[model samples]
Target: MAKRPQQSLHRPNDPAMLLLTSLASGPKHGYALLKDVEEFAGVTLSPGTLYGAITRLEELGLIEPLESVERRRPYRITTSGLTALREVTREMGRLAKISATRLRLSGEFA
Candidate 1:
Protein backbone atom coordinates (compact mmCIF):
# COMPACT_ATOMS: atom_id res chain seq x y z
CA MET A 1 0.00 0.00 0.00
CA ALA A 2 1.15 3.51 -0.67
CA LYS A 3 1.86 5.71 2.32
CA ARG A 4 1.25 9.40 2.55
CA PRO A 5 4.21 11.74 2.72
CA GLN A 6 2.39 13.44 5.53
CA GLN A 7 2.67 10.30 7.65
CA SER A 8 6.33 11.11 8.13
CA LEU A 9 5.26 13.80 10.55
CA HIS A 10 3.76 11.26 12.92
CA ARG A 11 5.26 8.37 14.98
CA PRO A 12 8.67 8.89 16.51
CA ASN A 13 7.60 12.48 16.56
CA ASP A 14 9.93 15.16 17.81
CA PRO A 15 9.71 15.90 21.49
CA ALA A 16 11.09 19.33 20.75
CA MET A 17 8.20 19.97 18.39
CA LEU A 18 5.69 18.91 21.02
CA LEU A 19 7.42 20.91 23.71
CA LEU A 20 7.80 23.95 21.54
CA THR A 21 4.19 23.68 20.45
CA SER A 22 3.10 23.51 24.08
CA LEU A 23 5.14 26.58 24.95
CA ALA A 24 3.68 28.40 21.99
CA SER A 25 0.60 29.13 24.07
CA GLY A 26 2.56 30.45 27.09
CA PRO A 27 4.96 29.46 29.85
CA LYS A 28 4.44 26.14 31.65
CA HIS A 29 6.10 23.99 34.23
CA GLY A 30 7.10 20.41 33.58
CA TYR A 31 3.87 19.05 34.99
CA ALA A 32 1.82 21.53 33.06
CA LEU A 33 3.61 20.57 29.92
CA LEU A 34 2.92 16.93 30.58
CA LYS A 35 -0.75 17.59 31.01
CA ASP A 36 -0.98 19.80 27.95
CA VAL A 37 0.81 17.32 25.76
CA GLU A 38 -1.36 14.46 26.93
CA GLU A 39 -4.48 16.51 26.45
CA PHE A 40 -3.63 17.37 22.90
CA ALA A 41 -1.52 14.49 21.59
CA GLY A 42 -3.06 11.64 23.58
CA VAL A 43 0.46 10.53 24.38
CA THR A 44 1.82 10.22 27.87
CA LEU A 45 5.45 11.23 28.12
CA SER A 46 7.64 9.76 30.80
CA PRO A 47 9.57 12.05 33.09
CA GLY A 48 12.74 10.92 31.38
CA THR A 49 11.40 11.68 27.92
CA LEU A 50 10.09 15.05 29.02
CA TYR A 51 13.29 16.06 30.80
CA GLY A 52 15.45 14.77 28.02
CA ALA A 53 13.63 17.03 25.61
CA ILE A 54 13.75 19.86 28.13
CA THR A 55 17.51 19.53 28.51
CA ARG A 56 18.02 19.50 24.78
CA LEU A 57 15.75 22.48 24.27
CA GLU A 58 17.67 24.38 26.94
CA GLU A 59 20.97 23.49 25.32
CA LEU A 60 19.62 24.70 22.00
CA GLY A 61 18.47 27.91 23.70
CA LEU A 62 14.96 27.22 22.53
CA ILE A 63 13.57 27.38 26.04
CA GLU A 64 14.51 29.17 29.23
CA PRO A 65 13.71 28.62 32.87
CA LEU A 66 11.77 31.04 34.98
CA GLU A 67 12.44 31.89 38.61
CA SER A 68 10.70 29.40 40.81
CA VAL A 69 10.89 28.90 44.52
CA GLU A 70 9.30 25.48 44.46
CA ARG A 71 10.70 22.23 43.13
CA ARG A 72 8.70 22.58 39.96
CA ARG A 73 10.56 24.73 37.50
CA PRO A 74 8.52 26.39 34.76
CA TYR A 75 9.88 27.20 31.33
CA ARG A 76 9.00 29.51 28.50
CA ILE A 77 9.82 29.26 24.82
CA THR A 78 12.46 31.61 23.51
CA THR A 79 12.14 33.56 20.31
CA SER A 80 14.10 30.89 18.50
CA GLY A 81 11.75 28.20 19.77
CA LEU A 82 8.75 30.04 18.44
CA THR A 83 10.41 30.44 15.07
CA ALA A 84 11.27 26.76 14.86
CA LEU A 85 7.78 25.72 15.86
CA ARG A 86 6.18 27.96 13.28
CA GLU A 87 8.45 26.73 10.53
CA VAL A 88 7.84 23.08 11.35
CA THR A 89 4.06 23.38 11.54
CA ARG A 90 3.98 25.44 8.38
CA GLU A 91 5.86 22.72 6.57
CA MET A 92 3.55 20.07 7.97
CA GLY A 93 0.54 22.02 6.84
CA ARG A 94 1.99 22.41 3.37
CA LEU A 95 2.72 18.70 3.14
CA ALA A 96 -0.78 17.81 4.28
CA LYS A 97 -2.27 20.09 1.67
CA ILE A 98 -0.12 18.60 -1.05
CA SER A 99 -0.98 15.07 0.04
CA ALA A 100 -4.68 15.85 0.09
CA THR A 101 -4.54 17.39 -3.36
CA ARG A 102 -2.77 14.34 -4.75
CA LEU A 103 -5.25 11.98 -3.15
CA ARG A 104 -8.14 13.95 -4.60
CA LEU A 105 -6.65 14.01 -8.07
CA SER A 106 -6.18 10.25 -7.90
CA GLY A 107 -9.83 9.80 -6.85
CA GLU A 108 -8.67 8.21 -3.64
CA PHE A 109 -10.13 10.74 -1.29
CA ALA A 110 -13.52 9.88 0.20
Candidate 2:
Protein backbone atom coordinates (compact mmCIF):
# COMPACT_ATOMS: atom_id res chain seq x y z
CA MET A 1 0.00 0.00 0.00
CA ALA A 2 1.16 3.52 -0.67
CA LYS A 3 1.19 6.21 1.93
CA ARG A 4 -1.49 8.86 1.52
CA PRO A 5 -0.51 12.52 1.32
CA GLN A 6 -0.88 14.46 4.52
CA GLN A 7 -3.80 16.85 4.67
CA SER A 8 -3.48 20.36 6.05
CA LEU A 9 -4.59 20.68 9.65
CA HIS A 10 -5.53 24.34 9.45
CA ARG A 11 -8.91 25.98 9.29
CA PRO A 12 -9.26 29.15 7.20
CA ASN A 13 -10.08 31.38 10.18
CA ASP A 14 -7.80 29.85 12.74
CA PRO A 15 -4.96 31.88 14.22
CA ALA A 16 -2.32 29.63 12.65
CA MET A 17 -3.88 30.02 9.23
CA LEU A 18 -4.24 33.77 9.71
CA LEU A 19 -0.61 34.10 10.68
CA LEU A 20 0.51 32.03 7.73
CA THR A 21 -1.59 34.14 5.38
CA SER A 22 -0.04 37.33 6.72
CA LEU A 23 3.47 35.93 6.45
CA ALA A 24 2.76 34.98 2.86
CA SER A 25 3.32 38.60 1.92
CA GLY A 26 6.68 38.74 3.70
CA PRO A 27 8.51 38.17 6.94
CA LYS A 28 7.29 40.11 9.97
CA HIS A 29 7.84 40.36 13.68
CA GLY A 30 5.12 39.70 16.28
CA TYR A 31 3.90 43.30 16.51
CA ALA A 32 3.93 43.72 12.75
CA LEU A 33 2.08 40.44 12.34
CA LEU A 34 -0.59 41.50 14.78
CA LYS A 35 -1.13 44.76 12.90
CA ASP A 36 -1.14 43.15 9.49
CA VAL A 37 -3.58 40.44 10.54
CA GLU A 38 -5.88 43.08 11.93
CA GLU A 39 -5.62 45.23 8.84
CA PHE A 40 -6.40 42.41 6.47
CA ALA A 41 -8.57 39.98 8.45
CA GLY A 42 -10.29 42.56 10.65
CA VAL A 43 -9.37 40.28 13.54
CA THR A 44 -7.53 41.63 16.52
CA LEU A 45 -5.17 39.28 18.28
CA SER A 46 -3.82 40.04 21.71
CA PRO A 47 -0.10 39.72 22.40
CA GLY A 48 -0.58 36.39 24.13
CA THR A 49 -2.67 34.99 21.27
CA LEU A 50 -0.24 36.22 18.63
CA TYR A 51 2.91 34.89 20.31
CA GLY A 52 1.24 31.63 21.19
CA ALA A 53 0.33 31.03 17.57
CA ILE A 54 3.85 31.99 16.51
CA THR A 55 5.39 29.52 18.91
CA ARG A 56 3.14 26.71 17.67
CA LEU A 57 3.89 27.52 14.04
CA GLU A 58 7.62 27.54 14.78
CA GLU A 59 7.44 24.21 16.52
CA LEU A 60 5.61 22.71 13.58
CA GLY A 61 8.51 23.77 11.32
CA LEU A 62 6.09 25.87 9.31
CA ILE A 63 7.92 29.07 10.22
CA GLU A 64 11.40 30.09 11.34
CA PRO A 65 12.72 33.01 13.32
CA LEU A 66 15.17 35.41 11.76
CA GLU A 67 17.89 37.44 13.39
CA SER A 68 16.54 39.90 15.91
CA VAL A 69 16.59 43.47 14.76
CA GLU A 70 16.54 46.21 17.40
CA ARG A 71 15.06 43.83 19.94
CA ARG A 72 12.33 42.58 17.62
CA ARG A 73 12.63 39.04 16.31
CA PRO A 74 11.13 38.47 12.90
CA TYR A 75 9.72 35.30 11.41
CA ARG A 76 9.55 33.93 7.88
CA ILE A 77 7.44 31.13 6.51
CA THR A 78 9.32 27.99 5.64
CA THR A 79 8.79 25.98 2.47
CA SER A 80 6.43 23.70 4.33
CA GLY A 81 4.52 26.70 5.51
CA LEU A 82 4.04 27.92 1.94
CA THR A 83 2.81 24.52 0.90
CA ALA A 84 0.36 24.42 3.75
CA LEU A 85 -0.87 27.91 3.01
CA ARG A 86 -1.42 27.07 -0.63
CA GLU A 87 -3.38 23.99 0.31
CA VAL A 88 -5.56 25.91 2.71
CA THR A 89 -6.12 28.68 0.19
CA ARG A 90 -7.28 26.26 -2.42
CA GLU A 91 -9.59 24.65 0.05
CA MET A 92 -11.07 28.01 0.98
CA GLY A 93 -11.62 28.86 -2.67
CA ARG A 94 -13.48 25.63 -3.19
CA LEU A 95 -15.62 26.25 -0.16
CA ALA A 96 -16.38 29.77 -1.28
CA LYS A 97 -17.39 28.58 -4.72
CA ILE A 98 -19.73 25.99 -3.28
CA SER A 99 -21.22 28.51 -0.89
CA ALA A 100 -21.79 31.02 -3.65
CA THR A 101 -23.45 28.43 -5.83
CA ARG A 102 -25.78 27.37 -3.05
CA LEU A 103 -26.60 30.94 -2.15
CA ARG A 104 -27.37 31.78 -5.75
CA LEU A 105 -29.63 28.77 -6.10
CA SER A 106 -31.54 30.05 -3.10
CA GLY A 107 -31.70 33.57 -4.59
CA GLU A 108 -29.66 34.85 -1.72
CA PHE A 109 -26.67 35.97 -3.75
CA ALA A 110 -26.38 37.96 -6.93
Candidate 3:
Protein backbone atom coordinates (compact mmCIF):
# COMPACT_ATOMS: atom_id res chain seq x y z
CA MET A 1 0.00 0.00 0.00
CA ALA A 2 1.17 3.50 -0.73
CA LYS A 3 1.93 5.74 2.21
CA ARG A 4 -0.92 7.99 3.13
CA PRO A 5 -0.39 11.71 2.98
CA GLN A 6 -0.68 13.68 6.18
CA GLN A 7 -3.63 15.98 6.46
CA SER A 8 -3.05 19.70 6.83
CA LEU A 9 -3.80 21.12 10.29
CA HIS A 10 -4.77 24.63 9.34
CA ARG A 11 -8.20 25.45 7.90
CA PRO A 12 -10.13 28.72 7.91
CA ASN A 13 -12.54 27.47 10.54
CA ASP A 14 -10.39 24.86 12.17
CA PRO A 15 -10.37 24.85 15.96
CA ALA A 16 -6.62 24.25 15.93
CA MET A 17 -6.10 27.35 13.85
CA LEU A 18 -8.31 29.34 16.19
CA LEU A 19 -6.35 28.14 19.18
CA LEU A 20 -3.06 28.94 17.54
CA THR A 21 -4.24 32.40 16.58
CA SER A 22 -5.38 33.08 20.12
CA LEU A 23 -2.11 31.90 21.64
CA ALA A 24 -0.17 34.07 19.26
CA SER A 25 -0.88 37.03 21.47
CA GLY A 26 0.24 35.38 24.72
CA PRO A 27 -0.11 32.32 26.91
CA LYS A 28 -3.60 31.44 28.01
CA HIS A 29 -5.37 28.80 29.98
CA GLY A 30 -8.23 26.76 28.55
CA TYR A 31 -10.97 29.14 29.63
CA ALA A 32 -8.99 32.17 28.54
CA LEU A 33 -8.41 30.58 25.17
CA LEU A 34 -12.12 29.95 24.80
CA LYS A 35 -12.97 33.54 25.59
CA ASP A 36 -10.26 35.08 23.39
CA VAL A 37 -11.19 32.99 20.40
CA GLU A 38 -14.84 33.79 20.87
CA GLU A 39 -14.18 37.50 21.18
CA PHE A 40 -11.82 37.78 18.23
CA ALA A 41 -13.28 35.15 15.87
CA GLY A 42 -16.91 35.21 17.01
CA VAL A 43 -16.80 31.46 17.39
CA THR A 44 -17.59 29.68 20.64
CA LEU A 45 -15.84 26.41 21.35
CA SER A 46 -16.97 23.82 23.82
CA PRO A 47 -14.50 22.57 26.40
CA GLY A 48 -14.22 19.24 24.64
CA THR A 49 -13.46 20.82 21.29
CA LEU A 50 -10.91 23.20 22.79
CA TYR A 51 -9.02 20.50 24.66
CA GLY A 52 -9.11 18.15 21.70
CA ALA A 53 -7.44 20.73 19.50
CA ILE A 54 -4.96 21.52 22.25
CA THR A 55 -3.92 17.89 22.39
CA ARG A 56 -3.36 17.72 18.66
CA LEU A 57 -1.44 20.98 18.59
CA GLU A 58 0.80 19.83 21.41
CA GLU A 59 1.40 16.52 19.69
CA LEU A 60 2.50 18.37 16.59
CA GLY A 61 4.89 20.47 18.76
CA LEU A 62 3.07 23.63 17.75
CA ILE A 63 2.18 24.56 21.31
CA GLU A 64 3.48 23.77 24.76
CA PRO A 65 1.92 23.84 28.18
CA LEU A 66 3.20 26.26 30.75
CA GLU A 67 3.21 25.85 34.52
CA SER A 68 -0.18 25.47 36.06
CA VAL A 69 -1.48 28.40 38.05
CA GLU A 70 -4.07 27.62 40.69
CA ARG A 71 -4.84 24.44 38.81
CA ARG A 72 -5.42 26.21 35.52
CA ARG A 73 -2.94 25.02 32.93
CA PRO A 74 -1.79 27.60 30.47
CA TYR A 75 -0.31 27.04 27.05
CA ARG A 76 2.00 29.08 24.86
CA ILE A 77 2.67 28.80 21.16
CA THR A 78 6.09 27.44 20.33
CA THR A 79 8.39 28.89 17.70
CA SER A 80 7.25 26.19 15.32
CA GLY A 81 3.68 27.20 16.04
CA LEU A 82 4.42 30.80 15.07
CA THR A 83 5.95 29.66 11.82
CA ALA A 84 2.99 27.41 11.07
CA LEU A 85 0.55 30.19 11.86
CA ARG A 86 2.41 32.61 9.60
CA GLU A 87 2.40 30.13 6.74
CA VAL A 88 -1.29 29.42 7.17
CA THR A 89 -2.07 33.14 7.40
CA ARG A 90 -0.22 33.80 4.15
CA GLU A 91 -2.06 30.96 2.43
CA MET A 92 -5.39 32.31 3.64
CA GLY A 93 -4.52 35.78 2.38
CA ARG A 94 -3.73 34.39 -1.07
CA LEU A 95 -7.00 32.48 -1.14
CA ALA A 96 -8.89 35.53 0.02
CA LYS A 97 -7.38 37.62 -2.79
CA ILE A 98 -8.42 35.08 -5.36
CA SER A 99 -11.90 34.88 -3.89
CA ALA A 100 -12.25 38.64 -3.87
CA THR A 101 -11.11 38.91 -7.49
CA ARG A 102 -13.52 36.24 -8.63
CA LEU A 103 -16.35 37.79 -6.69
CA ARG A 104 -15.65 41.20 -8.16
CA LEU A 105 -15.53 39.80 -11.67
CA SER A 106 -18.85 38.08 -11.09
CA GLY A 107 -20.39 41.32 -9.78
CA GLU A 108 -20.93 39.68 -6.41
CA PHE A 109 -18.67 42.17 -4.65
CA ALA A 110 -19.11 45.93 -4.69
Best lDDT goes to which candidate? 3
| Model 1 lDDT tens row, 1-110 | 74332232242367767888889899999999999999988878899999998997887777899988488889999987777666668777777678879777534432
lDDT of 2 by residue, 54-96 (tens): 9888887889999999999999999988887887788777777
Per-model TM against the reference: 0.81, 0.85, 0.87
lDDT of each: 0.78, 0.83, 0.85
Give me the displacement of residue 106 in model 2, in angstroms: 12
Q: How many residue pairs clash in each candidate?
A: 0, 0, 0
Q: Write the per-residue lDDT of candidate 3 for residues 13-107, one digit (tens) a residue.
A: 79999999999999999999999999999999998999999998898888999999999999999998888888888878787778889777535
Model 1 TM-score is 0.81
Superposed Cα RMSD, model 1: 7.2
Question: Candidate 2: where is the Cα deviation over 4 Å?
Answer: 1-9, 105-110
What's the lDDT for residue 102 in model 1? Answer: 76
Best by TM-score: 3
Clashes of 1: 0
Ranking by lDDT: 3, 2, 1
